[model samples]
Target: MTFRLSVERLVRIFPAQGGAAEPTRAVDGVDFVATAGEITALVGPSGCGKSTLLAMIAGLEPCDSGAVRAGAVTVTALSAEKSALWRRAHVGFLFQDAGLVDRMRVIDNVMLPMIYRNAKPRDRRAAAIAALERLGLGNMIERRVDGLSGGERRRVGFARILADPRPLLICDEPSAGLDADNTEEIRKLLQIARADGACIILATHDPELVTVADKVLPMRRGQLVAPDLALRAGAQQAAAAS
Candidate 1:
């Protein structure tokens, strides 16, 4: 199977307090592959480095060892400028916070990525509107982002990522501030993205998010374990006997 994203023996370390001790290993030799059209959920307790790994994958942070490959490109050796270009063209990031420009209109916030990429203004507006429609936020397009509720703000963020149309989407705690209804809506949006051939990596502490994942990676003390494998195998055995 072809992987849209792969991390091979990746390691990331953060400087210790006072800058005199050994750096702390935030991600300890992690390896994983996200196949195209699949959702991979990274779940862990707070402070366990799930976000750290996601940032590395997004090229927002550098790794201390090993390689990160997005499709055919190796990100580890790319210059900062090249990495930024790669991210602009191939990656969409959704932060734990809505990360909207509060002063901007919802539609404008959703169009920001395309604008940064220098898309034609008319084309960008149309695409942003379409994305907002897809997220069921078409009616909120003209409203200021600061005026929207948490769920609405999150939808705007999702619309932004959808408008970007990147093949790789990395989201940190997408369902963080959502209610049950909003969370389900976001999950459906993620499923749609996966079906459209985007590889999605979502970092969250929510078990609800794990239920929809193709693979669930649990992190503890900066190490990941594949808990979903055992769970699925047991389910398969039970089904065989039934």
Candidate 2:
């Protein structure tokens, strides 16, 4: 099933820490709609609130204001107690840090999400093996994680996304630290997922991946930056560097 994610004037502010008077506004009046079959790339510098916005969209954090509508479900309003169940129902998240369990085998890590949702052992095992194979880690499924590189570990982390049957795919820095070949594979995987009618919203700084985005939402200091201006500026810089 296809899913549409709508964010309307979303706002989340953090209280000042270490005695500063001004509270940090992590997400400020953000608004955008991510629909099925398209990849929306949130492009920006490291400190920008792109990750924060994604957290709200994934229902991993609370927004002080606004609403997140995924299909018929309102994401932002879900209580903390139900966050896991809600996420399991509608979202598949690939954490920025490649959130895989270091001590577990690749197959075990991939099946963890389904286990959290109480999926039957037989079913989750099959799904986990399938996800591993699709991401080119089929042989590594039984191998100890100590044998994998950082990029390979990240691929194992992403395998979790495929095991869970969710329509909206959220990835943060999906290609970070990957080799050129692995990065290309990640891009191809994103395209394949999009073709299968999943709505994808990812935060990325890779120019090659940016070129593939159907829409680029540039951001700075908790606000949306104008796309045309950013693109023109990038073009001028590229021209100057060449």
Candidate 3:
């Protein structure tokens, strides 16, 4: 299988801000591969550097050492402008916040990224609407983003990323602030994305987020730890019982 994203001994360090100690290693020689059409969950406690690792893969932050490859492209060697372009073309990022424009309508927000790519206006709008429909938000196209509920806003963000049609999707705390029903909806959406050949890397603390994951990597103290088989078996049994 072709790997959609690969991290080889990736390392990132943050310099001390206000006369603190030496540079801290946020990510320390972690390695993983995300294959196309699969969901990889990164789960751990807070301050485990999950978000930092995702940002480095997204080219939003620089790595201190090692390499990140999205398909055949080397992210570490790309210039800032080239990295931005590469991300725009091949990566989609969903943060904890929806990050929508309050003044824009739901569909418009979804179409904005396509606009930056110079896609045809009519085609962009059509694609946005289709994406929203896939997310079960078809009827809310004309509504202002500010008026939507938390779940609805998240669906809109999911639609926006889907409309971008990127191969690699990175989600940070996608289940944050979502109730059970909304969480399931997001989970279903992610499953659909995986079916459509997108490689997903999800960084989240929620145990519910791991239910559908193909592989789970637990991060702790800047290292990627293996998932506990006993815990996983217990979780599977509980899920079956439920």
Candidate 4:
């Protein structure tokens, strides 16, 4: 099916942690459409609401207002119980921190999502093994996560998302802190995901990587700058320089 993830007037507010009077308006009534089989890159500097927008879309963070319509499901509007179920069955998220349990074995960590979703115990082991193998982490499956290097652990995080890919992939900087080769690996994995009709909304600062995006939305200080306006502005700069 050709799926589309749509966000309308998404907003998020964070209270001051240090007893400050004003709250932080992390996301300010942002809106956009992300289609299946293509990557929609949220290109911006740090603290520009990219992560905040994604968190609201993924239902991890509460939004003061907005509607998220991904196919038939109303993402941002789900109840707590339904929200967990919705994320497990339809959203394959790669959190910025790679949200892995430090005490678990690498394979077990990769399999945790399925375990939470109540998959057949007998089938999960084999599936986890396959996901690890596909990510070139087959030999390290038995290792504890704490024992692994940063890069190795990051790959394990990737394996977790691919263990059971959903229709939509909400990846937050899936390639951060990687060498050139591993970044390329992430790029290829994204291509494979898109080929299988998964909708990807990636938040990234890498311009070279953003080139693969079907639509690039620039954000700053919690507002989105439309791609059309951004393009025309770029062209004006080029013409003036010439």
Taking all chains together, each candidate's TM-score versus the true structure is 0.86, 0.89, 0.86, 0.88
Pull out the clashing pairs in model 3. none
Q: Give the TM-score of candidate 4.
A: 0.88
Task: Give the alpha carbon lDDT tens digit for every residue of 1-242 in model 3.
Answer: 56578899999989887898877778999999889999999887778899999899999999889999988899988999999999888888886677799999998899988988999998998899988998788999999999999878888888899887788999988888778877887888899899999999999878888988999888876788667753565577689999
Q: lDDT tens string, model 4, 69-131?
A: 888888888898888888888888887888789999998999998898888887888888987
User: What 10-residue stretch in candidate 3 is worst by lDDT?
Assistant: 225-234
TM-score of 2: 0.89
- Report the C-alpha displacement of residue 16, candidate 1, in angstroms: 1.7
The clash count for each model shown is 0, 0, 0, 0
lDDT of 2 by residue, 54-163 (tens): 98999998899999998888888888867668888778889887887778888888998888888999999999998888888988999867678888888987888977
**Model 2 residue 32 lDDT score:** 92
Worst lDDT run of 10 residues, candidate 2, spans 228-237
Q: Which residues of candidate 2, in runs, are more than 4 Å off?
A: 19-21, 144-147, 231-242
**Of the pair 2 and 4, which is ahead by lDDT?**
2
Candidate 1 residue-wise lDDT, 1-242, digit = tens: 45478899989888887866777788998998988899999887677788889888988899899889987899887999999999999889997787899999999999999998999999999999998998788888999999898878888898899887788999889887788877887889899889898899999877777788998888766787667754665477689989
lDDT of 2 at 224: 82
- Regions of candidate 3 where Cα sits further than 4 Å from its true position: 1-3, 18-22, 147-149, 229-242
